[model samples]
Target: MEEMMRSELVSMSSYCRRYGHLKLHDFSNPSFKKTKYSPTKVFVVSSSSSNSTSPPPLPQNPIFQSFFFPVTPSPIIPYLQHCSRNTKKRKFTPSSSSGSVKVISREAFNAAVKKPSVAVKKPTVAVKKPTVAVKKPIVDVNKPTVAVTHDRGVRKSSSWVKSRLLGKGGYGSVYLATSKDGRYKTERAIKTAELSRASSLMDERRILKRLKSPFVIYCYGDEIVREGTSDCYNLILEYCSGQCLADVIEDNQGGLSEFDVKLYAKDVLSGLSYIHDRNIVHCDIKPDNLLLTPVDHRFRSNGFLTKIGDFGLAMEKGSVEYGNGCGHKRGTTRYMAPELIGHGVIDFAVDIWAFGCSVLEMLTGVQVWGEHGDLVYDDWVSLIGHSDLIPNIPSWLSEEAKDFLKRCFVKEPNARWGINELLNHPFLSSNQVFSHNGFIYE
Candidate 1:
């Protein structure tokens, strides 16, 4: 029995060595029983069993049966061949009925070992920017190019007719306009200029609309008239039948009496006080701009009313252009105040200075600076800007008149008297009464 067992063990060892790819364990080793692999049924062949009449009875022990199974080569041979062809790790599962091993494929093993798949990200697309439309400014035809208070209704061109040309100047032409339907009992004066050159007229219209006084010329409204092929801007105003103060002075050939001067001064000062109270400065004040309208006998006998006009160079108080020498050339050089010509300083005081110059011109039929004949523009600027120079007052005038003129010609505008103070001066504040028809002035 021991010899037969030795021979069978030697035969199994030789078969394992022949098929080394199968990696079969040596059954003769003691550690083979203690391996982690589960117990599997294997078939063994004896070296001396080819022609035996009957196979030896198989082992009856279960442990020996697991290692040496007497099975035909058909089933076990094919399974071993498939396992030898594969390269992946092998897993064994014991068959319940036959106690045989089953082989797992490389594809099945890879599927079990695969990691969880990651989500794929989509590609980004480019976006476009939108275009914007630019808008142009819209201009209203009815609106004046320069802004002003239009308290009165606008008059149409067909509402009035131009009877004749009254005068013309840098501002344009003045016409005697009569209402076609006689809506206005008195004739209306219309100052017209080309649209491009009507800014000063528009400014005058703006200033006049806010001022309401018997001494200040009235402004009805304004309109745009088409003349020939060009458009013209028109300022509707109150017409004065009598001549301007400059014309009156010329006709007289000499200065008027103190009584007439006093009356005119009171009227002009009243208008100046009205405008100055409203924070307006008349940069240009002269005799040519004053209108004398003859009053009816019922109101006053042989009396004429004085109205201030031509506000083309007027400006609001504290405006940036007020004293910055903006309209210096347009303003009468002789009437410019010392502060205005020297340092571009201006205010209500400058108007007082100009008023003094206007009064001096009224006392004498000649211009205030007419004595300096043919002096160029720069020389006049130098002369007016001089600190020591002042307008000459006539020696023949009364002490009150000379003193009144002195108050207006002060070199320092701060020291010069205001309209309120001048109105209270003895020259204008006379106790003597003058009565003509029913009109009385004291």
Candidate 2:
């Protein structure tokens, strides 16, 4: 019986596929059409004949067919029962007229119980609920921001007053901010970006919190400020009123005195030493990234203190091993090492190369690429081979200072002197006194 039922089901499916428009309609009425939700197969019919009677022979042309009698156990009932058992319960109702056929919706079929057929009414229209205004999420002003890491000083954005725009770049902008709290004396520089730029900014904030060095910019905390629709992130960092080393050079008629260069370079090297010791590389080391803070009373002098800033391009040295190929080029173009430009193996030496370029620019008041006023790729290629094609060394700079730069400019990364060696060089030693904190001297 099961096998016979399966064969009938397969045949019915085939028929539906062959004639998708096949549907039961009143043969006496040509105007009748099927509805959008009408079933494709299995037309039902009512008969006054006994249950033991077999259905009358189906006409060869279905368009002219008419039901004469009903078969025992109605062939459709067993099939529909099997289908309903295999699937879900559905509601169904048979037509009232003794010889009329009925169509039931899938929903009606699923909801129906086994009983005598009855007329089904059309579904009614449903009313929708009224909309209500949604309020913005209320933030607890007392709650502190807790990111990937947490610190005690983290506070709400409302507590800080954003003053003027300090600077702006691809990552976003830096604004001068002051705390409303009287305990906060010094102004803070808040680096901000839209939520779309959260990843890089968040990474920087995490890194800043882990670092603790006098030469590196200090991070206080972070906060999220809500705009009309979108939110923005604000990273609080130590503000350097004296500005960047690049600006300082511009103020000094495009170049710094040899003494000043040595002093600033020592400060940069101190930061680099601390960073490299922790296995991190400051990939984008340049004058712009070296911020100058005014000398405190302890180091009373007109000279400003240099600190490394802008750690957006920093990366852990051994995080991911690189195969023998050019890695992605990162960092300022003018300060890029030859290997960095060629997509060669990158390491701490790249920072050393950039430091050399920065030092040269400070002394000569010229760009690394514009050293001879006619810089070219060929010059870089020659330098990569240990050729004596160094950047133009000013005659005013002592030979010791020139030699110290040459050591930093060595094409072979392994041959280049590191931060510790560079710090101890005679040139940097001439102006700066070591052993103050013993951090750099050690």
Candidate 3:
């Protein structure tokens, strides 16, 4: 039996080495392009199950045990799994009959891998009869269900039969939920509101549906439902995990470095240009709305790919004009544009204005438009009329960054910077080969 066990293991080992590429036990290399391997099988050999009554001891578990395992050549990669060991030193590789797997000492391996305890004793429990037939409390069959709530509206809010808080909004609440039908399951954010605001929420949805871009956060689903004490509609959205650029900046304390500001600003512009091309105007663009995609913190991550989310105040190109006093201001105070207050179409220029504001915020930890006052509009006019009101470019910014932003914050929208120009700008173009892990830190 021992001879047979040795023969079988030898065959397995031979098979693994023959197609090592396909069954690479090494976990360190993620790049599959290094070799052409074809795995044919993956096996978990249990010494306890061998025909030989006296099984070999366990070896110390290797960090890259998969590297030693046999693999099947199927396209579907199979992960190596082993039951955890409690009593013995667990090892990964199979050595010769002399117990040559070097990761662990022979004594430790024997002590660690003892046979599982057997339950041979006949165990019995005394049974008792219940005096009463206890029943669970019944809920009212006709009671209304709770509506999903969220901090914001997003596509995940529109699931059916999942009456739970999906998320919360500054104006409403959101719920993260799963639907009764697994097919409908989604991680979502929903904005809740009184029935009176249904029309506005729908309007926002209409604008959101038409705008598309990889840089923009997408709406997944939506629904109008009744919340506690009031009938309301909820806007569901895709789950985005990173802090808004606002929070990221605040976390940095003083402000973003010049390089990061340019990086984030470029993505913001790309998102805007996509929306504008579709004739949609994001009336509100602020740090809260400009989002970043979360990534592994250990590795270097890009803050540059900012996804523009939350189109609640967005409008289609031909939508009716809304002045500040007449409607729900529809924008953050500081980011609101001069033309937006006049009930004019503000066009795509409003977004450009907001983008400029965001850039200033990124450079200096202050809102570009300052507070609303007599000088507010006057400041905008002067800034729009004269280029100096824009935040002073940090000396660290490149000459190209200075020119790119100068174009973005131009006094006139028509003359302002466009997406293509910004993308091709020197700041982004300079990085030929980049990686989050300092392959190219700059």
Candidate 4:
């Protein structure tokens, strides 16, 4: 009986493959792409006659089609196959119903994705709750928002036209939309994380809301979108017509000099200092996050108008300490700090560490670490010693750059000077231009 059943299962699986591609109504839904769902396959599961009293024929199930295919499971698989062929005998009834498939609902099938027998590893994800206690941003009572949103900050309807997709990010999608009157237009960036929820993301929203600086993108709104048990949220923002620092330098070929670089760095540090004073940590800081505006009279007053953008990886002070069990690791790996590698407690200096890397790139036309820049962190570390951690400094870079780097990239986070002090440094205060190729920073 067992052998017969095994053969039946194997045969049924094979039958499914024949018509598996036949058009079946909506079914299979890949959770990541929520809108694009795929339904389960339908197969002929009935016998030839409607009145036939015989057992129901297990029409080849497309779901189990993999088993029907000719596959040598393994070295041991050969032995099992031989034994099964010799010992097992099964009977199968043919079905006459037109071949069709049913796509299993995600609710039922999400339980055992891929196949049976494969043990799945459960991930640790935060179950974020909506904070009714928190107040919404102060929008003009007169300027209309989505109706009924004034109470709980929840949109009464999905009237927010996706508008044009401004940009797609790792966590969320961005769109460009104007107010109902076209008087105010802002860039709406939605943040999403596959492995986790957006509870920890409020740090960015909170920081952006308080900021009223020309160097920071103004956040216009915040809301959450939920699917099943998982919920995703986004931050609506004021659009900036500008190029990123990464693109600016790349287009400039190599790196920008002491003057333009310093100007960019100053504005960037000014933004960072503001974030620090507000008790926030911009954990993921890089040239790409820096936005450069078009030569407008307002910004032409300042050299390269650099503004800090994207705070998806930010955290509050002391949140990622050495002993904390948050297991939260976020930041660009190339520009990441040594302490943030794999499993280590990190501090605000981690931001400084990344800034040191960025400044080094500004000075030299290369990444502090990574391809087209330095590929290995150890090489840079070896070149620039962890002097504060050691009695004396390592010998590779000039005393000037080395000393400045040591002050910022301190091994211990607490002793590091905050962004304000770094801004006050002589290196940034001077109107200097280190030559690059033959063109000076005009």
**Preferred candidate (TM-score higher): 1 or 2:** 1
Q: What is the C-alpha RMSD of each candidate to the true structure, in Å?
A: 16.3, 24.1, 40.5, 35.9
TM-score computed on alpha carbons, candidate 3: 0.53
Taking the tens digit of each residue's C-alpha lDDT, what string does model 2 give over 1-442?
5675565556556654443323353323233232212132344434333342324322233222212112122344445545766775434454456444444677555568555677787788787778878896664322213344343333334457889998988889999988888886668998888866765667677567779998999998777777657777778899999898777777777587666677788889989999889877778999888999887534624447889998877776545422332465567766767677655556899999999989988887777767345546555544543354655667777798789899888877788998888887887765455444323322
Expressed as tens digits, the lDDT of each residue in 1-442 for candidate 4 is 5676687766655644432322322233322212111122122333323444433334544433333332322333344444656753433434345432233445445566755785677987889987788787886432223331223443333334456765666555566654453556533444433214443345556557667777776777566544445544555665555657766667766556555666777788888777777666777888877777655443443434777888766666544332352354667766666556544445667788777777766666665544435436554344333322321323544455556667776655678777878877776655555444444542
Model 2 C-alpha lDDT versus the unseen true structure: 0.69
Candidate with top TM-score is 1
lDDT of 4: 0.56
TM-score of each predicted structure versus truth: 0.64, 0.59, 0.53, 0.50
**Which candidate wins on lDDT?**
1
Tens-digit lDDT track of model 1 for 94-168: 344542235566678788789567777777766766767778656433233633424333223435688999889
Q: Who is ahead in lDDT, 1 or 3?
A: 1
Candidate 1 accuracy as TM-score: 0.64
When sorted by lDDT, best at the front, the candidate numbers are: 1, 2, 3, 4
Show how many residue pairs clash in every candidate, following the order shown. Answer: 0, 12, 51, 19
What lDDT score is found at residue 264 in candidate 3?
Answer: 81
Q: Each model's C-alpha lDDT? A: 0.73, 0.69, 0.58, 0.56
Clashing pairs in 1: none
Give the CA lDDT, 0 to 100, for residue 356 in model 2. 93
